[model samples]
Target chain A: MSNFNLKVPTMASMMANGETPEILFWVGCAGSYDERAQRVTQAFAKILNHVGIKYAVLGTDESCTGDPAKRAGNEFLFQMQAMQAIETLNGYKVTKIVTACPHCFNTIKNEYPQLGGNYQVIHHTQLIADLVADGKLKTKDNKVFKGKRITYHDPCYLGRGNNVYEAPRFALEALDADLVELKRCKQNGLCCGAGGAQMFKEPEKGTKDINIERMEDVKESNASIVAVGCPFCMTMLSDGVKNIDNLSHTAVLDIAELTALSNNL
Target chain B: MAIIAQILFLLAFISAVTLFYKNFKKILRNIQLGKSISRNDNKKLRWLMVLKVAFGQSKLAAKPIAALMHFFIYAGFIIINIEVLEIIIDGLLGTHRIFLFLGGFYNFLIGSFEFLALLVLFAVFVFLARRLVLKLKRFSGAEMTAWPKKDATIILLTEVVLMFAFLIMNASDHQLQKLGQAHYPIAGWFPVSQYLQVVLPTSAQALVFLERFCWWLHIMGIFAFLNYLPYSKHLHIILAFPTTWYARLNNLATLDNMATVTNEVKAMLDTSLVPPTASENATFGANDVHALHQIQLLNAYTCTECGRCTEVCPANITGKLLSPRKIMMDTRDRLVEVGQNIDRNGNDYVDGKSLLGNYISYEEIWACTSCNACVQACPINIDPLSIIIDLRRYAVMEQSQAPNSLNNMFANIENNGAPWKYAAADRLNWANNLSN
Candidate 1:
C-alpha cells in the first residue's frame, strides 16, 4: 500500500533486541484504515521522525481502544477488546504513548487507568508543541498557509472530554496562518455529529444535522480551511463541507497535517 | 358530645391513613420490582446531598424568580405542618387551641401561620397563572396530557381552599371569643384573621356554626391532600428527600460501569479465574422496567415532570425526537402499568409488551448524544441517560438489532481488532513516505 521507504520499528522487534523506545506510537484503527485519516497519521509520524524522536508502533499487535464499543453500550465487547490491548501494552512495559487520534488518546489516557493500563499519553499536537517549545523541532518559512484564514474544530473527546484546547491551537499558530475562532469554540464548541459512536451509525433524522450546523459556524468564520484534531471530526466535517455546493474549495485537515504541510515536511 | 366528636375524629383519621397506606404499599411493590443496587455507602455525603438539594432547594435557585416563588410555597408547606400538630391534639382531646398554654408564643405561631398562609395563597395563584395564563413552555408538552395538567391545577386549588378554610376558622373563633362564648378562651391575636373578622356574620349562632364548618373542612382537606400525594406529581414533596439521598454520586459526566459486567470481564482477562457461564436468557441491557435498578425506578417517581431536563437536552434543542423528560415519564407510566398487572395477575404476569416499543421508541433513545446535559439540568438528580444507555445496551446485545453501520463496526472490531475494515499488519503503512 506504500511506496517510499521509512525506517519504522515495531515494539516487538525493539523489545526482541533488548531496546525500549522513548514513546509508543499508537496507530489507531482509523489512522490505520481510513484513507484520509492515514494522511494525518503520516503527517504526525513525519514530525516525530524529522525531530529525531525514537518511537515504535505496536504494528500487527495494536487493537482498538474499545472507545466506540463502550460508547455504543456494548460493555462486554468493549471489555474484551480493552483487556487484550492492556495486556499487550503492559507486557511491553511501555510508559509513554503518543497518538494522532483524540478518540484513542482520550480512551487510553482517561479510561485505561481504571482498567489497569496506566501510561503517560499525549496527543500529537501536545507532543509537537512541547518539541517546538524545547527547541527540538524548528519550522521553516514555507508559508503555504501563511496569511490564509483557517478555522479550528475542536473534537469533543479532546476538548470537552479532556480539556486540551490550547496545544492544538499552539501547533496551528506555528504555521503563521490567521487562526479564526468559530462562534462556539472551546468549552462551548458544538460536536461534528460523530461522537458517542455516531460515526458508526446513521444519524437519527432531525431538522438539521449537527455537523451541518457546525459547518455553518465554519463558513461564518470565512475560513477556507477547517483544521481539526480528531479523525472522526475530519470525516464528519469533510462530509459536511462536501454537502455544501458553494464550499468546494474549502479544505478539512488535522492540525498535524497542517503543521507538516506548513513546515514543508 | 365531646366523646362523640373524638370518636368521629379518630375514625376519619384512621380511614385517611388507611387509604394513604394502600397506595404507599403499591409504590413500594413497584420499586421492589427493579433490580437491587447498592446506594447505602457514604452516609454522611448522602445526607448532605438531601439537605442541600432537597431540603435547601439549592438547584431551583438557578432561576431566581421561580426559586423565590417555590421557596414561598415550600416554606409555607413545612411551617404550616406545626399548626397541623395542634389541630391533631385538639381533635383527639376535643379541646380548643390545646397549645394555648404558651400564650404569647401561641399568638406568635398563629400569626406566622396566617401570614404564611397568605403568602402560600399568593404563590399558588402565581403558579396557576403560569400554568393557565402564561402557558410556560416547560409546562406544555406532549407528555403533559390532560391528567398531569389538571392534576397540577387541582393541587394548587386545593391548597388555596385549605388556606381559606384556616383563615375563616380563625376569624369566626376570634368573633366568638369577643362575644365571650363558653370555652372560647381569649388567647391570641391573628392579624390577618382579625382583618377577616369584618366580613364575618354578626349573629352568635351563625358564627359558631361557621367556625365549626371551616374547622372540619380544613382538616378534611388536609386528609385528602395526604392521600392524593401518592397519585400525583406532588409525591415529590415526600420522595425528594430519599431520592436525593440515594442519588448517584459520580460526576455528572461519568457514566457508571456495571460492576457485575466489569468483574466478569476482569475474570475473562485472567484465564485461571473462571468467568461465570453465560446464561441463555441473560439480557444485556434493559428491555423492561424490571431490568433497571431500584434507584432508577425511584428516580422515575421523584420526577416532578418539570421538563427542565428536556429543556436542556442537546437532542431536543436540535429538534430530535429524544426528550429526557419524556423518558422518565414513560418509565413511570410503564412502572404503574406493571404494578397494576402484578396486582391483578400475581408477580409473574407477562404483559407481552416491553418498555422499548410500548413506551419509549428506539428512535428517541438513538438520537441522544450521551452528553449528560440532561443530568446536569435535572433539579432532583434524575438520570434519564442511565436508562437510555440501558435501553441501547438491550438494542445491541439482546436483539442484535443495532443499525447496519454499527453491525459492520462490531464485526470489524471482532475480526480486525478495530472499528475499521483494515488489517493490523498494514498499520505501519502510513509511516512509509514520512522519513524521506
Candidate 2:
C-alpha cells in the first residue's frame, strides 16, 4: 500500500468526510475474493485514480450481489443478499456504479432495477472506453503487446445478455495490439460454461465440456493473449488454455489489466 | 319425419358439446392449480402482440414454404366453418341450400369455400410429404416418437377426409338438382364437385341416399375434430391467442425476480421492518404443476409441438439431454396426469411422479445455458427457461442437491463475502507494489 500510495476510500469514510463520490466502484465477489480477479479490480482502481475520478468501494459493507443464488434457483437466498446490498447502496444514495465483473454488472444493471436499487450501472470497459475517448487516460507506447495477436472472448452476460460488443474492443484498441475474433463471437459467442451459476457447480457429465470446446476456438485463432471482460470467463478460459497441449505459450488477461499495462500504470 | 330428424340432430349435438365442455372444464381446473400471476398489465401491447403473433401468424415467416402451406390450411379451416351455420340449420329445419336465398352473393361464398377446401387438401398432402417422405430433421427426434408422430398423421388425414366429404356432398347435390328433384334448390356453381357429378350413379334414388350420407358424415367429422383437439397438439388453434397475449414483452434475456423473496430481503435490510416468518415450506422451486405460474400453465396448453424451440437450442445441437420441446410436452403430460388423479381421487390427491424427476431429469435441467434461444424460437412465445430456473430453485434450495462445485461456492460466499476462499482483508493485496 505504501509503495503504490493508493488512497482507497470506503463509502463509509467518504460519507464521514461529507464527500459524495460520483460513482460507486462495485468490486464484485470475484473481484474481491478470486486472486486472478483481484488483479482486475486493482487495475481498474489505478485507472480511476490516475484519471482523477471520484469513486469509492463499499469495503466491509460489501456483500455478494446474490447473482449466483438467483441464477442457481435459490431465489430466497438471492433476495436476502440483494436487499442488503440495495439498502447499503440506497443509504449512500449511489447514483452511478461501475464494476469490473460482467456478472455483477449485469445483475446490478438489469435485475436491481426491479428491486428498487436502480443506478447508472456500467461495466468497467464501457467506462474505460469513455475515459479513453475523452483523453483523460493517455495510452503510453508499449512494445510488449504491440502487434501481438489478442482475441477478445465475449462474456455471455455482457455480450448476448446486455448487447455490449464494442466497448471492450475500443479499450483493446488503445493497446495497439492486432485484435482478432473467434469465429463464434459477438451475438453468437459460445458460453465459457460459467454463466447461469455454473461456476459454483460441477458440470454435468457430457461428451465435451463447454470450456474445452470454447478453447478450441481460441486455439484456432492462434492468438497468444485472450482478452476477457468477465472474471468467471477469465477463470474458465485460463483453465481451458492450461488443459490445451500448448499450455505455457498463452495468457488470459482482463480488459482492465490490459489497459493498466498499456498505460504503464 | 321432420320432427324425427330434428330430435336426432339435437341428441348428437348435445352429446358432442357436453363432451367438449367437460374436457375444457378439466383443463381450466388443472391450470387453476398453479399460483395466480397478473399478466394483466400492458393491455395495449398485449393486444398488439396477439394480433401480430396469433392472428397474423407472423413468426411462421421464418420458414416461408411451411408458412405458406400452413396459411392455406389455417385460412381454409376457419373460412369453411362459416358453412357449418348452414349445415346446422339444414339439419334442424330439414331444408337444403338454406343460404341460397342470397342469390349471387351465396354463389361467391360457396365458390370461395370450395376453392379453399381444395387448397387445404393440397396443403395437407404437402405437410405429409414433409414429415413422412422428406423426413425433415426437426419433425423427427426423440420427442417425436410414437404418439406425437401419430398425432400429426391423424390430424392431416382427418382434415383431408373431411374436405373430400364436403366435395362429395356438393357433387351429389348438384346431380340431384339437375334431375329437378324436390327440396334440392338450384343454388351455386361447384367447379370441382361439378366434375365429380359424372362419376356418381345415374339413379335419382341412389343419388339422394349418397348426398344425405355425405352430408351427415361431413357434419359429424367436424364435431369429432373439435373434441380431438384437447388430446392433440392441435389445441394451439384455440389457445394460441391467449398465450401470445400473455408473452413476456420485455427483453428476452431478462429473468423475472421472485417478488416473495425480494420483500423479505427488504425487511432484513431494515431491522425495524418485520420480516415475514419463514414458512417451513416443502420446496423452494417447482416440484409439481402447482408450483408453476398461471401463464406457464397456459404455455403448456398452447405448444404446437412443431419442435422449433428444440431445433434452435444450443444444448440440443451439442447433444445435451435438454430439449425445450420435451420440457413443454412433459409439463402438459404431467398436468393432464395430475388432473386425472384429481378427477379420480379427491382434488387433494397426490401423484407419486413429478415433472422434475419423473418427466424432466436433473441432468436435463442442469444442461441448460439459459440462453433464451428456445424462448426466441417459439412462435407462440412459450418460455421453457422460466420453468427450468424454477426447478433449479427447488434443486438448490429445497433438496440442496446442487453439484459439489456449487456447494463450495456457496460456502465461500457465506464466509468470505465473496465467491472465493480468501479473506476480505486480503482483497487489497492486488493493488500493492503498483507503479502508480
Highest TM-score model number: 2
What is the lDDT, from 0 to 100, of the residue B349 in candidate 2? 85
Q: Which runs of model 2 end up more than 4 angstroms from their true locations?
A: A1-17, A31-61, A124-190, A212-229, A233-265, B1-4, B171-211, B259-273, B276-283, B433-436
Per-residue lDDT for B1-436 in model 2, tens only?
7789778987888888899999988888888899888887899999999999998989888789889999999999899888988998888777787899899999888888999989999999999999999999999777778999999999999999899899989999888898999878788779778888878999989999899888899999988998998999999999999999989887656778876666566676676877466554544579779999888998998898998888866567667788999999999999999988988998888768899899999898888877666776688888988999999988887799887777776777767766667786776555555546
| RMSD after CA superposition, every candidate | 5.0, 4.6
Deviation (Å) of B233 in candidate 1: 2.1
For candidate 2, write residues A87-206 as lDDT tens digits.
899999999999998878888888888988899999999999999889876654666588899999988788877888999999888888888999878866777887788787677766
Q: Each candidate's lDDT (Cα)?
A: 0.85, 0.85
Docking class for candidate 2:
acceptable
Best by DockQ: 2
Q: What is the lDDT of residue B298 in candidate 1?
A: 93
How far in Å is the alpha carbon of B125 misplaced in model 2? 2.9
Write the residue-wise lDDT of candidate 1 on B1-436 in tens digits: 8899889998999999999999998998899899988898999999899999999988887678888888999998999898888888899899999999998999999999999998998889999999999999989777889998988999999999999999999999999999999988997778888888889999999999999999989998999999998888889998898889898775443455555577788787776886566444556799899999899999998898888878766567667888999999899999999999988999888979999999999888888776565775677888898999999999987887777888898888988888878776777677665654
